[model samples]
Target chain A: MGSLEYRCLKATGVYNVLSEALVEIRDVNFAYGHRPILKGMNLTFPKNKVIAIMGGSGCGKTTLLRLIGGSIKPTSGYVKIGGQIIHELDRAGLYAMRRKMGMLFQFGALFTDMSVYDNVAFQMREHTNLPEEIIHDLVMMKLHAVGLRGTHDLLPAELSGGMARRVALARTVALDPMLILYDEPFAGLDPISLTVVGNLIKRLNDALGATSIVVTHDVQESLKIVDYLYFVADGVIITEGTPDEIKASNKPFVQQFINGEMDGPVPFHYPGGDYQQDLKLKSIERVKNNKRKVTERYFGLDRRQKKK
Target chain B: MMAALTKNFVGLGRRVMNSLWRIGIGARFLSLILLNSGISFSRFHLTVKELFFSGVMSLIIILVAGMFVGMVLGLQGYETLKRYGSESALGSLVALSLVRELGPVLAALLFASRAGSAMTAEIGLMKATEQISAMEMMAINPIARVVAPRFWAGVFAVPLLAAMFSVMGVFGGYLVGVVLIGVDEGSFWSQMQSNVDFQHDVLNGVFKSCVFGVVVTAIALFEGYDAPPTAEGVSGATTRTVVESSLAILILDFILTALMI
Candidate 1:
């Protein structure tokens, strides 16, 4: 862990700021109807750097990613990529913004209908006038980058989960995007696959000089590659720190989450109209007169327990 | 206690309102899908083959099913009307019933059930798996890239399919009326054709089918796009798209007939 922390620190320092930051989200708020999902969220991504957004489920990490990616508009505030504002753009503008960015979905999200070659060639066919042979070679080159050469005819369903994700990653970067957004890249993967994906992400970022924003629940793997880190909860960014700083963060919620504790600042049970029932149960349990039955029923203690 | 119950009721109402509002957002997203689809027309040539395939190929099934439907309707109508000794009215009955109303409505409903459900499920799975978001990140317009092909495919396909259905249905009626029921083949077709104006009723039916196609495709795509990121959510969206789109088609057909007639 110490060596890994030192390496990450050294890597963070080596990230070139000259490549230009592709996306900068500032003080954004999002809501699913009346329920707030993100509150005054702010983030910036320098080009060619791999940043990780880590949080528990429903923490608006994905929401932040969507806002930057221009899939969803922020209810308040704005996201700017270079000089252009995302929310001010129409569909074409958004599409233009999106073209510069590539995203890797958790399950790979490869079109099950299309083969690997077609999947990688989707954007090329859509946006470019490249000849068929050139497109084919480009797809093969991308597949080769992900170590998936010669599997161009295979459908998404035919591949293993890890392989499918790799294919998706290959397809994503096939456009040679300037930015990459990875939503839970390491989630639901075995250790070997996780490292493979992690290494691939790092390699893609290095090779393409593309900025990456990874949203993940896998803290350790995410920390291994991410230069900058954002830890979010309750629809708001609670803290932003370097990987080592996040590991050393004493913030209560972050601590509780990282340590995998059941009881902490984050409540397990929802506080609802059941407060009366809770109070009633507490009162009943507090009554010493009910000890014999309470011990036998609630605690599941046998009659020999009193003797002990 | 009554006040608490009232508050709970109010809360429930608010929650319901919130849900409805979210659905409206989904609808708006679908409209955005339409706008994006319109933008996709700039790249229409590439999609022309798919449009032709999804349009021309799917017509076969509708044709076969529609012929049987017309035959069945003719057979059943003939049996019922013959008892009243008004067998001559069969031409008007079948023509009015099919060309004016049942032909387009039934075809739209069938198409919605089969193609609409599959589209909803496919896109719902994509949404649940965050593929839509992935497309957005790659600066690929999912509406342009995914939904537009389907939208235009359905838009162009449904009407053609409806026309084929009408033709096959008339032929099926001819087969039953002339061959099985001993009505002269030429006279049966002539009577049916003479009574039904292709421009007025059939064209109107085609128009309504076009509307139905849009409605079905919109509903399916909207439900799929708005689905929660869960297996159950995907399934629910698929089911809702099929049910709601079918119902919407029926309702629209009735309204259109009432207005057009």
Candidate 2:
């Protein structure tokens, strides 16, 4: 029927690539002082999808969230959110941009002195000129979504660990941000709370049509809800795919991390010389250390213990 | 011996470098407090809460210390002035010492141990808990929201407390010097009135206390802001706040006395 148009398309030898990403991180490098944390890290999160960034602890997952939120500038490259570069923006511009982004820090990080109601109402009151009646209803609704409306007047310290995290989750989404970044949202919760939080994350992302990046070490729980997975180690993305592919992959790091293997690309012990040789050296050092401790000790306080 | 000497030199150099770095960061922290000081007025509720904690809570200790110190001064001055055949000058001695020396310096030292340390510990705990970062993620500035109100409360609270301290001290001195020891009340009042000038003694002490207030609170907040995020780190910050603020108050008192008195 359209023979001439089909021939013209085939002659171009081109194919369609991924659709546009909602948040793009291109060649981002981050470091604290001179020590590198993330090196040449690149990622893209699609609109209206939940993605998991899985890695060992101290693998710079929280650092990624900080980079996206413009809390810290990348050492090398750029992070672009909704077509705007984050680190390049001025303070006012950055804040204006962050209004569309929400983050749930590890350990809940609730305002310790505020009541549950006030915590949830904080964003609305600060960003909008809403009347008190409207703010109260909105705060109640958010708390209700997290099943904590009954605890409205409770201080953060009064709430249990799971309840506090749930309240924190409600506050993070009070503005219906375009993107939500959660750092270890399920680390300290019980089984029921973990599943509830996981489901809430997925359900809220879908309900708000918001992109989500969950930086966590909970592989199985994250695999249950995330649309895609990126497993990072030693400051680089080793592999990424759909949950099914990651579950079935044979890559060394992937297999080791997913199955909870003791040893793989990530070693269990600290790096050093051979074990037997180190043991011999360690014994000699132990004798020397004991002699030094007695000489350095004062009133039952060892210098080393005092340093600690 | 040379190696030990070299090691000592290196340690000294490192400490000097670290001190310089602390001073640089402290300057920036003070500038940030000044920049956000306007927000303290607008955020009146938080400032009032901070005042209750940092100001009202310090009052009991300040009052007790003031009263006791005043009684001691009254007794000591009475004995010494009596020997010089000018027992009436006891009021001048007590009033001048209380206004020009003891009230400002002692109140500030007490404040550093109480309110300043508490401020550092509270802010450092917030940082350790990631509450500061969470606020930033919500597009709120921590400097304005967290540090400003506390800074303003301390700066306003310290001078008021010093004035109260001096007043209570003078009252206590009168109780011991006149009512108990049988010094003539008329000479006591008249001598104090003649000797203690408002501008030179009282106002200058107020100015000294105000400056000490700023430096003490600044050290507190700066240490808190700069502390590493850990329990031990917060504890260390609290200790540093007390020590540094106390030292700063004493040094500032000396300099102000030389300049103003």
Q: Residues B1-261, candidate 1, lDDT per residue (tens digit)?
A: 999999999999999999799768877876777776765577676457556655666677788888998898789878887899866556666776777777778878777777777778888888776677666666667777788777787777778778788778877876787678976556566666688787887788888888988888777777777778788998898888878987888888879988998
Residue A218, candidate 1: alpha-carbon lDDT: 87
Clashing pairs in 1: A98-B138, A98-B139, A99-B139
Give every candidate's TM-score on chain A: 0.82, 0.84
Clashing pairs in 2: none
lDDT at B77, model 1? 75
TM-scores for every predicted model = 0.77, 0.91
Stretches of candidate 1 above 4 Å error? A1-44, A58-60, A72-80, A83-92, A228-308, B1-34, B39-42, B45-61, B80-93, B259-261
> DockQ for each candidate?
0.60, 0.67
lDDT of 1: 0.80
lDDT of 2 by residue, B1-261 (tens): 999999999999999999999899899888988897777898698889998999999999999999989999999999888889998888888889989989999999999999999899989999999999888889988999889999999999999899889888998999999999989999999999999999999999899989988999999999998889998999999998998998888888888889885
Instruction: Identify the candidate with maximal lDDT.
Output: 2
After superposing all C-alphas onto the true structure, candidate 1 shows an RMSD in angstroms of 6.2
